[model samples]
Target: MAAVTRGSFSVLRQLLSQQYRRRCFRLQNFRSDRTLQPLIFRCDRNLQMFGSRALHTAIVSQGPIVQFKLSDIGEGIMEVTVKEWYVKEGDKVSQFDSICEVQSDKASVTITSRYDGVIKKLYYDVDATALVGKPLVDIETESSSEVIQEEDVVETPAMAREEHTHQEIKGHKTQATPAVRRLAMENNIKLSEVVGTGKDGRILKEDILNYLARQTGAILPPTPFQEIQTPGPAPAPAAAAAATARPVSTPATKPPPTTPKPVFIGKDITEPLKGFSKAMVKTMTAALKIPHFGYCDEVDLSRLVAVRAELRSVAEARGVKLSYMPFFIKAASLGLLQFPILNASVDEGCQNITYKASHNIGLAMDTSQGLLVPNVKNVQLLSVMEIAQELNRLQALGAAGQLGTGELSGGTFTLSNIGSIGGTYTKPVILPPEVAIGALGKIQILPRFDANDQVVRAHIMNVSWSADHRIIDGATMCRFSNLWKEYLENPASMMLDLK
Candidate 1:
């Protein structure tokens, strides 16, 4: 009787399997028809189905949130600092709108929005470091098809402040750029108390400065002069305001008897170096490892000065401001032709030396940002006039802080004119990858004995050199220096090597 009962259960299971197979075959046939497509739809309450098949539905509908990551800005930069943000959380932005600016080791670059959306979150604040390929901001895109439910989206600190920021915007809260806010923070001034004269009631840097001037009763020049008709102690506030009112000058008086003010112990403020300054720190550290051969000498520049003066008018007519830099650079390139080792770089193992074919001579510029050495490409092939033109172009870009990485790298040699800023001599440190660096001192008119032993005034300039001792000996460095000096002393000699 037990065997018969087991056989009956087995037969029932077999029949059920056959029935399920038949149903699946029918579904497959239904799917094959082009007109009859698989349909996903809500069934009765608490159920969803695709055709006749039940599906586990856990779909959460929300607008597409894009995490905008910091991208590589070229020149092998791995990271950047968040310099400024043009938009904050909850602000609406269009595609291609400049949302933020970042400072890399090379230069400052403004990043644009890739989507038309509302700024949902900012992952970084001003002056914060951001790595390439990491999210910088989150944006809720407008073009997303999915309908976003408020409860479905996660609320973050940045998003929580969005409503508050919106309310502030409606109430005409103080609007200022990041730069203006930084200035206020440095001076310990409150932007709320300072009146804004900028468009749409925005606080500017000038406003902060003016406010400080008024409080201190110091007449700051360039403060907008306004006539205050009301005169009294009551109207003093207006008169002291640097923006709206002119500062009132009072007669000087002796200080009252009181305890002497404590000697100022300078406050220590720490800040991470960014952009070119940061690059300099790393480059210089590596440069110190190279054993340097130092050399210094003087060259008579009387003929060079006269030659420059003669060409100045011609250069001005061509819209180029000619300077001693072009001649110095040109002469260096000419000297390199004779002494190629000066333009060569040694390998890390110090087993091989590379003599570069092109004389890409770098010029050290002292900019407001930091020391920048931008090279003129193929100086060996460029004429003095051409070099001068390139020099002007580079100087302009450097001054405006818009120089590119290509303009700053790939140098076979470097030249620094410390004389322009009032230096007699400087032992310039060599920039690696290529070996030698030269520094020129200020031109001085000193009396020197001529061939006839009579003292005469002559234009003299001092030059200091630093070379890789592993590759360049003192004798070779001196010989190279002499050749360069000879070219400068006789300005006409450089013309022979001009392309």
Candidate 2:
């Protein structure tokens, strides 16, 4: 009798289950059943009422927020500091409008807006460091409803966490700050290849620096890590009370070494380095690592001086300011034709040398900002007059701090006219990759013995050269210098090579 009763109850339960499933199936096809459409809508509306109205309707009519990230402004630039901003929050901006100015290790970069929008937020302040690929500002831009709906669908925290987990599982995302990623990119090191030691397996800047130090056998700052606590589920009140009673142990972290601040003896003003001055510091640090071969000599510039004076009138009529730099640069190009090795660059491994096809001679100028070496592109193809015109343009631009990255890079050789600022001889540092650099001193009127062995007044200029001793031997540098000097001494000879 008990078995019969149990079987009857099981049969009734199965029938009720079937009925519930049929009702669910009809509701799932509510669009086909017009009678249930209003009921389903009413249920949806009731559920939405429990949710925040602002969360759903707040951004429905408004435009989407766009993040303006910093891009690669120059080669090998890892980070830049915000210098100034032209727009602020709530300001309306048009496409291609000036947004802000930033200073990198290479040059000053002007950022412009890519979209027409209102500035919603600024991520960085003046003098704050901003990493490449990081957001510099937030802009509110107009968009279509379809795009807005798509954004809203994925706006939940659960959806975001799921997407992040998916990327992590697929190994498509790297856990790192933008600065760390940039450093890895600059060194050609893959972030996945290095072991991270930060929270939740994130890579820090110190990790990259330490990895590099290990590879190069360099002594770097010590790495200090704090104690990491694993998260767990909450316990009952009684268990939590017992856990709280127990003493917690924390690992000690070593403090980083600090340098002693300098004490001033008198009135001292502190100034921060930025832009060109900051770039020069980094450049000089790297340049000093290469072995330099030095060569010094004096050239009789009396003939060249007279030739320049004769050409001044012609240059002025053409609305060009002709200087000795054009003749000096043209002569160097001619010398490069005879000895191409002086115009070549060597790899860090010293296994290969690149002989450049173009003579992109760089001319160093001292402006109010700092020292700038803007080069004259394809000096080999340009005439002396053309070189002079380009030189004038670079100087003008440098003075106004408006020189572009292209104007400042790809120099095959460099020339510094220390004479303009008053110097007899200067040991110019070789701008790396480039094998040689030359410095010209002020021209002085001095007596010298000519071929007749009689003392005569002549315009003599002292020149000093520095070259990469690893690739350029002393003999090679001297030979190149002599050839360069011959053209400057006999200004008429450069005309033979001048096409």
Task: Note the residue pairs that clash in candidate 1.
Answer: none
- Which lDDT tens digits does candidate 2 get at residues 1-499? 9999999999999999999999999877775778866776777666678566766777665677877666644366768878889899999986546688877766666665656678999999899989876778887877554544543444333343222211121111236666777788899875533545676445678888876764453423222222112122469999999988988543345584488899878987897886677888978998998898788999998888788778877766665667788888998998899889999998878789999999999988886567888798788877887777667667756756766565778899999998877888888998978889999988788889999999988888899999998888998888888988989998877777787
lDDT for each residue of candidate 1 in 329-380, tens digit (9 for 90 to 100): 9899988999999999888789999999999999988876688888998888
lDDT agreement with native, every candidate:
0.73, 0.74
What lDDT score goes with residue 264 in model 2? 75
Q: Give the C-alpha lDDT of model 2.
A: 0.74
RMSD of each: 17.9, 24.8
TM-score of each: 0.63, 0.64
Q: Report the Cα lDDT for residue 398, model 2.
A: 70
Q: Which sections of candidate 1 miss by over 4 Å? A: 1-63, 142-266
lDDT for position 47 in model 2: 66
Predicted structure 1: lDDT: 0.73
Candidate 1 — worst ten consecutive residues by lDDT sum? 223-232
The Cα error of candidate 2 at residue 380, in Å, is 1.3
